[model samples]
Target: MCLLFRLYFLARRMHLSWVKSALVLWRNIMIKVGIAGITGYTGEELIRCLYQHPKVKISSLYARIEKPIHFSSIAPRFNKKIDLMCEPLNAEHMGDNCDIVFLALPHTVSMEFVPFLLKKGKRVIDLSADYRIPKDSYELWYKHEHTDSENLTQAVYGLPEINREKIKGAKLLSNPGCYPTSIILGLAPISKLISQCLIEPIIDSKSGTSGAGKKAEASFLFTEVDENLRCYKANEHQHIPEIEHFLSYEAGANIKVHFSPHLLPVRRGIMSTIYLNHESFSSIENIQKMYNDFYKNEPFVRVRPLGKFPEILDVAETNYCDIGIKFARGMLIIVSVIDNLLKGASGQAVQNMNIMCGFDEKEGLF
Candidate 1:
């Protein structure tokens, strides 16, 4: 009788020990994420998305401040939810605290911290133009000397639709620019068709003022932007090379675009209308079907029905890219829309993080 009682207690103790071990393993799986430019627009958006992520904990927030301040003090919307302090920018501290670090800084700034974070064995997703293009192209376009060329060669372009597999194994991710995100996705499905039959495509893209970033610029002021639609960079936008580079890779041929970016009178979205003139014989139905097939399994890309169009409102504040196709006259028109800050910047950053960490691709996006 005593032997039976002892066996029962021993078995129960083993079961409890197993349960405790499982709990510890589960807790370790939650990733500790950090954001660098935490006071900027993209940084704030990153916080908002990461706060809702089931497998993440925002371990650190860095900004260009002299002292630590509450994160909610910088962005009031996160008042009750994220009660954390935003510390001064320190690459060493960030690397020590976070398993993954997101660089939401401006173009030239991200390059400064990326190399250090990478050395510390931390995965990095950079939301800037620093690592997107080659060194020479970056200097020619942004007028800034490329400081980090070693990592530039290895950084994976973070567009999940086209580079999902690459992103999965990426330790350094270069998030696509806002304009390139909309334009590339719009042109990706028909890349082969364009190379075979089309001439240089004409791209007319318009974006909200928020694409400019959170800065005190005279041109982006309310009086200047409100009730105004202005075309600024025509055929000379910095994103021209980036759009051509990736699209060319997709089509296996050199693809150039006459990209014209306009400033819209809104706050947060991008709409790109691409005019592709092809000499081949294909009906509008076939083209629509191709687009549907191309993005059918994609989680964030939504192809609109034939003869239907997408507006900026369709993908506003969401990580979705809504694309529409139409054949008018001798031109094949493709319209693509996305929130410049979400799919264009921070939401896509988190998506890359999810892919790198082996989490579900759409874990926190929806």
Candidate 2:
């Protein structure tokens, strides 16, 4: 009886040791994520998406605050879901705590903190225009001097459909803008066709008021935007150069877009209607097939059926870019739609992080 009792206790101790080891392994596998600029729409969306991610633990939240405060206090929607604190923007503290840091800041502001975070060996995904184009283009269009030329040269453009392989190994990622996301994806598959036919694509993009960010501008006021449609930048928007740069890269020749952006009264999506001269192209059936073939392997891009076009409601509140094509009256019209806050900004950032970290591309998004 004494021998049997001692053996039972030994087996119980071994089982407890194995259980502890498994728990430690599970904790180690989770990615520790941090967010800077947690007050903006993109930042808030990031918190919402990352909180639902299975492999992520949001370790830190930073903003330009005087003292640390609960994130839920600022964004009440996350009250029960995310109980983290929004601390002041401390690069060192974020670097120490997080394996990856997302900068949802504006253009000039992201450059200030990126180099320091890189030096601390933390991967960065910037959802700003800072690192998207060359230094000269940025300076010319944005009217701001490019400060971090070294990192800018190395930052990979984070469009998973086009730059997936590069994104997998990128240490610094430049997330594409909302308008560019819809426009570029609409035209990427037909890049060679545009080059071969010498076609100059004309893009008319409409976006919701939220694309302007959380600001107190008179133009973006509720009274101004309610039931009103206005075209702000015509052909000379800052995003023009960015769109041209990537499309040019894909086409292997210089590609220029006659882009005009308008403000819609609604709150969250982007629809870019792209018109191309289809004089030298194939039939409508063949064009649709081509787009289908090109994006069949892409996870988030959904190519709609022939004679059907995508609407803003089709992709609202999701990390999806729905595209439809039509050949009519010697013009090939393509429509693309995406939720501005999701696929355009924060959701795309998380997708890039998944690729970089070797997690499933659709892990957090769905």
Candidate 3:
């Protein structure tokens, strides 16, 4: 009958419209993110950056407390913008709610939660020394037993400039330390030259007190650090193995570096001066050109011109690493600078997340 035909047509049209609506809904699905150790400095920075991400929604935030407290209460600037509370550590709840998780916990603590998150099929970017190196090296350097050694090989070092392809497919990302980031970015491009030219390079780096963390410590007090600059962990810094491991891979040989880290009186930023000695002098022009070519297409690395040098102000508060190169008196000195909290930790973590999630690498960073 005519009535039956009309009903059939109406149903077909409705089905087609339903299909279209479903497609649109799928396309606009936002990625839900969770942050563990939400009270830490890196976690705060992650919250700040990810809040602006177009395709992201911060679904959960976990701190080390029992009762819930509004995140805005701790960080009052985000009062109106972010309305979530910092919940207690519950890996199962985070894994159920979030598509990806950023672990800003202390070194050994991250390894404990990572296995649970991964078992629940969640991606993780750990901003700790836990998974940066192999288990043996981690135990040797950090003096802690790695509970999840099986996940070590699965973790990709989350330096976007050097490991973009690997980071894209990674489930676990080990965010580099502030010192390692500044030191590695400065040395990675010329790793081959460093291997062939120098016996040992002396890396002198200075970082602001914020690198010490937000924890209340007498050593990091205003009075203690006000007008003082001293070197700690001169040759025994934990980041030594991380820097050397990556550099050795790039150089295709064993390489050693003498590293010294100093604490500056300021708030945030790292300036690393790498002293290189070559058997024969390579022209400053060629050296600068080599660096320029190496990082020309990279979005985050900025190489200065031949006679100019980089300062902390050049890359402070941004996800950028600025390098200044020079050759003088049988030595090649490279100055690299970055904001310790941004390029060194949280911003880089977001960069890795963007890559892993198939978003633009610079998303939410600007």
Candidate 4:
């Protein structure tokens, strides 16, 4: 009887141990994710970020192609790290597998797949200009027909610093443009100043070749980009309207941005020099204090000390934006830098996903 009772208690203990182990395994289960347009620079960067994410498992990667292709064959760096195959963008297949879908597709392409993915109940974060603005504005700027106007109202602009609360409840997230991300964050803290004192902001932005995407073009060739610096779309860059729209909204005034974009020789990162003509320049000390106090609680924005400014290397490869302020003569100059592929695109998209899914804001980002 003593041996029988001992054996019974031992069996119970073993059963309890197995139950505990199962519970732990269930708690650590990862959320499944799908990526559309997985062949672009932003998509590749998204894979890089999600590969290290503890809470995410990439279920499928989609391209608008015919057959399945190995992921490593396209981006060799992900060879041993991710063994998944890139497949065609079939809504049924993705819907059956993933709860979240990231659209890293081009402007018009993302809109086509977004409605179907959303109908499948997959949360979407679009890294395109498609849903970033209203239908009419999109039609005007992108010069394309707007087919997804109904869902446009549902997309929250995915600039976490400005739209954190809205992003938390968003079903669709419109990731901001690279130029707009650097431009908006550099100027948001001083929106009140912009409204009250500023006349116009002349933005001179420079970005590396990778911001143009992985598409083969003569302008993006090695010889063209290596030793040359030239400005294109001087005052009519597509991002002009986007930057102006958001800044006007933030400043609570009608503001127009005089934007000029230049291509740099490097691979990634954007440095924007915003020259603001205000009624009068604030004392350098006061301006610095305002910027410091504004971003004091923010996680990713770093305001440089007085007399020191931001450089491309300061924020390259990281999901951080660095801003430096300078007052020259009667103009306030703000310099901001960010890695175009990371903070400006994929990293910001991940940040929005975290907010929407109730994960840590910095999860998979650091």
In candidate 2, stretches whose alpha carbon ends up further than 4 angstroms from where it belongs are 1-28
Candidate 2 clashing pairs?
none
TM-score of each: 0.91, 0.91, 0.91, 0.90
Best by lDDT: 2
Residue 27's lDDT within candidate 1 is: 32
Question: Model 2 reaches what TM-score against the true structure?
Answer: 0.91
- Give per-residue CA lDDT, model 3, range 1-366, as digits (tens): 223322333433455676444344432557889899988888889998999998899988899888899988888989999898889887667666777889999878888799999887777899999999988999999999888878988899988878887887787899999998998889887788778865678999999998989868888999999999979999999999999998887789888999999999999999999988875446878777778888999888999887578889888889999999888888888899999999999999998888776567888995
User: What's the lDDT for all of these models?
Assistant: 0.87, 0.88, 0.85, 0.85
Off by over 4 Å in 3: 1-28
The per-residue C-alpha lDDT of model 3 at residue 140 equals 94
Error of 2 at 255 (Å): 0.7
TM-score of model number 4: 0.90
lDDT of 2: 0.88
Candidate 4: tens digits of C-alpha lDDT, residues 251-358? 888777789999999999999999987655668788888889988988889999886788999899999999999888877889999999999999999988877765
Q: Of the pair 1 and 2, which is ahead by lDDT?
A: 2
